[model samples]
Target: MSKTDFSASQLIEIAKALAASGQNFIWVVKNGEKTEGEDREEWLPEGFEKKMQGNGLIIRGWAPQMLILDHEAVGGFMTHCGWNSALEGITAGVPMVTWPLSAEQFYNEKLITDVLKIGVAVGAQEWSRGERKILVKMEEIEHAITELMVGEEAEGLRNRTRALKEMARRATEVEGSSYCDLNSLLGDLRAMNLPATRTG
Candidate 1:
């Protein structure tokens, strides 16, 4: 879940979907003082923690997201499609269930689901910055998770993500495209500052 404001109802729905998915998961539910008048008891589906027991772990507040993504047991990611989160998912080679919220998140979602073909959409439509509630129902969320985590389609997504992971890794190496480009840029800048070459 995003650090951005999400309605209590939205939280409840997401919890229900994760429970219904029947796959083991770790959910980070941001911990803070309850919203103005909100009840913590109503934040999740009834008996959610108890029901999830051994199958799921819900961490209140911060969890080590990059570490979790790097674990081999992690099959997929349910994300808000923020740029940093998207990049983490790519580097970890995990496909995603994209639920865009605001800013450039929707664009990130499209890049993940459409251009990259390494994610599935949870059907979150409108953009919001907490001014309005954006709800993606349990069924839609579960379907997207299933799409990203099960069968042949899921394997294909994983393969593509792994390929991207390799590419990203290579881009950081000294001989890689990004490394070469940066060095080239530095050379250009250095040349430009070399106290203008003497003219004949």
Candidate 2:
């Protein structure tokens, strides 16, 4: 994953874009402490609060645990390619627009974008060498979000994710592979429960 930073202005821009797109029920999670050295009002763009008041854009400080992502209303995720987030999204059959933020995150992006085909990489910065900053402009962010929200690629990923989720469910059913493995382990345990051989 590559290191990246964003100003409050940028976040506000994103919120505005989401609003302009007529997105309903948009949720954003961020750090609680407001960044210093900027005007408080400017931290959030003018009219943003109004747009969110009844239009469905929700902005909250602090990261969401499991609720928002799991909600059916969540059609897309703008993520910092964490492995756990990737797995959760896949399991929930939610497609994502990945924004890697570290070395391992770059690798995870490969798994998501290249291997699993469940996500799209958005304005990825090279992870090689000492280069630390990979900036993604608001336009790219808007484009990626739009693409992932509604497009052929997004539909394909959604279908694939759903299939994968179903397959995972089947793997844990009573007659499934994991179930059989568990049964086999139980049998071994039962054998161990038998009386020990006297000659042993």
Candidate 3:
């Protein structure tokens, strides 16, 4: 449910994918205001939402995404590859289908897909910075979402995501990597007489 922007072609593709997948989804159109016009039907394929009404909940405006991702029913996410959203999905132990919008999100997608092995790339792995944009076909999106949701091929992705979630949780505990690193830094500062080590 990470339709980050209003790409008409991409949206249509996503609509088709959602319709074809037959999985339960909560799609959030982030910038629905862009379609405030008479040609709204043209904006989204006619009868698309109606056909999908049974299994999909298409929200036109804001949504509580963090809470939704945290839910047990949400097994995967359609992500824009934004770092914050990526981290949030990981924290929620949900795997992602990466659809990077622009900028460094492409890199983040790679980290998740290649390095972390916790996600699958939907489309547009190239960088888009107002100069060029890649249109991801509906079939690719459909395949990506299907694989993520219930394709049985996504078990590895889910397992890796859960492992990462545990690692992230452990990193915050008193004896974890993050906690130890913070203490080490503080100890060094204390040795240097830095006031940052003292209680305020």
Model 1 weakest 10-residue run by lDDT: 32-41
lDDT of 1 by residue, 1-200 (tens): 55776677877887888888888999887676465369655687778899999999988888899999999999999888989999999999999999888899999998998999999999989888764455678899889988888856999999999999999999989999999999999999998886767889
TM-score of every model versus the real structure:
0.90, 0.73, 0.82
State residue 61's C-alpha deviation in candidate 3, in Å.
Answer: 2.2
Is candidate 2 or 3 superior in lDDT? Answer: 3
Q: Candidate 3: where is the Cα deviation over 4 Å?
A: 1-4, 35-42, 131-133, 183-200
lDDT to native, each model: 0.87, 0.69, 0.80
The per-residue C-alpha lDDT of model 2 at residue 33 equals 43
> What's the alpha carbon RMSD for model 3?
3.9
* Tens digits of lDDT, candidate 2, 127-193: 6444334446667767777777776787888888778778867878999998999999999989888
lDDT of 3 at 50: 80
Query: Looking at candidate 1, what is the lDDT of residue 43?
Result: 86
Model 2 vs. true fold: TM: 0.73
Q: How does candidate 1 fare on TM-score? A: 0.90
Q: Least accurate stretch of 10 residues (summed lDDT) in model 2?
A: 1-10
